[model samples]
Target: MKTYTRITLSLLTILSLSACKNEEITPNRGKVKFETVSISSKLAGRIEKIYVQEGQLVKQGDTLALIDIPEVNAKLIQAEGAITSAQGQLDMAFNGATSEQLSQIDGQLNAAKAQMDFAQESFNRLQNMFQDSLVSQQQFDEVKMKLSMAKAQVSGLQAKRDEVTKGTRFEQIEQAKGQLDRAQGAKQEVLLAADERYVIAPTDMSIETISLEEGELLTPGYALFNGYKTNGVYFRFTIPESRIYDYNVGNTLTIMNPYTKDETQAKIIAIKQLAQYADITSTSPLYELSESIYELKVVPTSDISGQKFFNNATVLIKK
Candidate 1:
């Protein structure tokens, strides 16, 4: 019995030492994570339709949802009307008064010349009568005033006709052109706003969450969809200051999925100091709480397109 006890004690001691050695060689735990994204619109509207669901894979430029912004349609109509009015004004400036307008001015000038001729004849007759003592001084002066007023009228009409003959000024045409340009720019803005009504996927991604349901109001700058980039898988590990020297940026390492035993080669892309303990994603961290923690960002060295990855899943690194 004593011999058996001694042998069992020796075997237990060897097993204990082996367990300790394995513990000493264990590496820091890492977690798999993907690059996250949030998508929102610049204009506010009600959700009209949703084309994607959570966990759906989407392509770039795919329509994810439709927002009903009635105001955008109304504004578009207003912009079109403004463009029409501006175009009409610009055309008028470029093409001055029509032929009918010029003809009316000519007719008025001719009528004024006829009246002036009649007045001149009457004034001459009155002047001769006064010299022969047949007409009074008051009558001669009145006839002379009438002739002077008729000549002034003819001159004013001639000046008006000359002004009509001259087309619009350079400044007027420029002003009209500016108005048309402004209207065109406004219409373009409206068109862009209209496009905003359709929520589009900015890139290929996997939809993770939808913030609102159909018929819900989505405000400007509010995140409508939260997702992950399809090809942005990465690994993260938090190590203490004591172990940070074991890893460096650009160092190649092997990462294993603890659950599936799948392994992949990755390169350390960054080493950053963790400012907060809450940022640690390691499982069962054994480092002292007082020790400064650092993060290791690792990316796959080769293509990971065929591998399946999950966010915050457990992975391991062997030093």
Candidate 2:
């Protein structure tokens, strides 16, 4: 019995020392990660249709949803009207007065000239009477006033005729051109707003959520969570500042999946220090509370095609 007890004690002691040595030899730990993107609408409106479901893999430029904005429709109509009106104004500026308008001005000028001729003859007769004392001074003065008024009317009509014959002013033409450009620009803006009503994917990503259902109001800039891109897979390691010297950019190392024990070669792509306010979990919390933490990014150089890994999955760095 004493011999059996001694042998058991020795075996236990050897196992305890081996466990400590294995623990010391363990490699740095990291997590698998991928780039995530958010999807959203730039305009506020009711969601009319949803083309994708949660967890659906989508390609770049795919239409995800449709929105109905009453304001945008109204603005489009208004823009069309404005464009028509502006075009008419520009044509008028370029083509000058119409034929009917010129004809009317000419008729008025002819009538005014006839009336002025009659008034001039009457004024001449009245002047003769006043000089010969054939009538009262007040009577002659009234006739003179009539003649003056008729002459002024004829001059005004002649000026109108001349203006009608002349083409549009240069300043007026420029003003019309400006108005036309403004209307066209407004129409383009409306067209862009119409395009925004159709939600399109900006990049290749997996749909993580469908936040709003059909017929629900979607506010401008509201986010619908989209998952990480599959091809942009990488790993992130939160290492203590003291151990950062062991890794650097462009260093190739082998990384292993903790559960599957599958290994892949990855190259260090980037190393950045975490923000001062950022909180990170390390393999061991033996460092000071105020000690800085760093994030090491690595990308697989070997073909990881057959291997399946999820974002934030545990991975170990092999020295």
Candidate 3:
């Protein structure tokens, strides 16, 4: 019995020593995550030609597709013709009447003046004869009527000649010029429309998805392709809300790959204020907790030219 008690006490002492020497195990750290952005089109039309293929890389302003432009080109041609005609009309209005036209008006004015003079002479002769009792009152009245008709004809001719000599008025010339300008502007608009038929890349990005095919009709604001920058690849991670005040923009941090234990450096690019919430009953381990968090965007110092990390890649971040 004494031997049994000694053995039990010895085992208890060994268990106590082992428990004191054991170290606490640390919990595994989690990575940050972010939502992705998809790019879409601003204008829609039939896809005439595609300049890029699946998984192709493109730079900003690079032509990605060429839409049919026959209609727009035709309109542009029509606008050009209109502009030319309007310009010719404007020029004609600004220039005065030709020398031949002025000469014709002058000839009419001279003829009118001659007729008036002849009528005046005849009237005076009849008036004197009547006073000397050499002509009847009826003859004097006829001469006076002929003189009045001649004066009216002279006045009409003078007014007509003035109008022809004046050519176009300043306001008329200005109106023609305005029409020409409008035609020119229309031509420019048609040209711009034609240019818009060809869609180009907005930035140096990779083709994430292609939603349309050649000959497909698309409307404005349609999604034709999705793209993202290849070199600007970033990783987003969230820190606890309690640590939100510890970071700011342009702050530097170290990042590690949770799976491979590889380490890389990064910087804080932005922080979101809204709290992300998830249902407690949800099975998604990613959003098990509903709490406010600080979003951190970290970009690699070197170009991630050919690397494609998986979405929601687990990473370790350290200040």
Go through the candidates in order and give the C-alpha RMSD of each one to the true structure. 6.4, 5.6, 8.1
TM-score of each: 0.76, 0.77, 0.66
Give the poorly placed runs of model 2, Cα more than 4 Å off: 1-26, 114-157, 275-290
In Å, residue 41's CA in model 1 sits off its true spot by 1.2
lDDT of 1 by residue, 168-236 (tens): 889988999999999999999999999999999988999999999999999999999999999889999
lDDT of 2 by residue, 266-288 (tens): 99999999887644435436655
Lowest lDDT sum, 10 consecutive residues, model 1, at 279-288
lDDT of 3 by residue, 121-234 (tens): 999999889999999989999999999999999899888778757778888789898999999999988878877887878778778778888998877777787766655567
Q: Which run of 10 residues does model 2 get worst, by summed lDDT?
A: 278-287
Q: How accurate locally is residue 124 in candidate 3, as Cα lDDT from 0 to 100?
A: 90
- Candidate order, TM-score descending: 2, 1, 3
Best by lDDT: 1
The TM-score obtained by model 2 is: 0.77
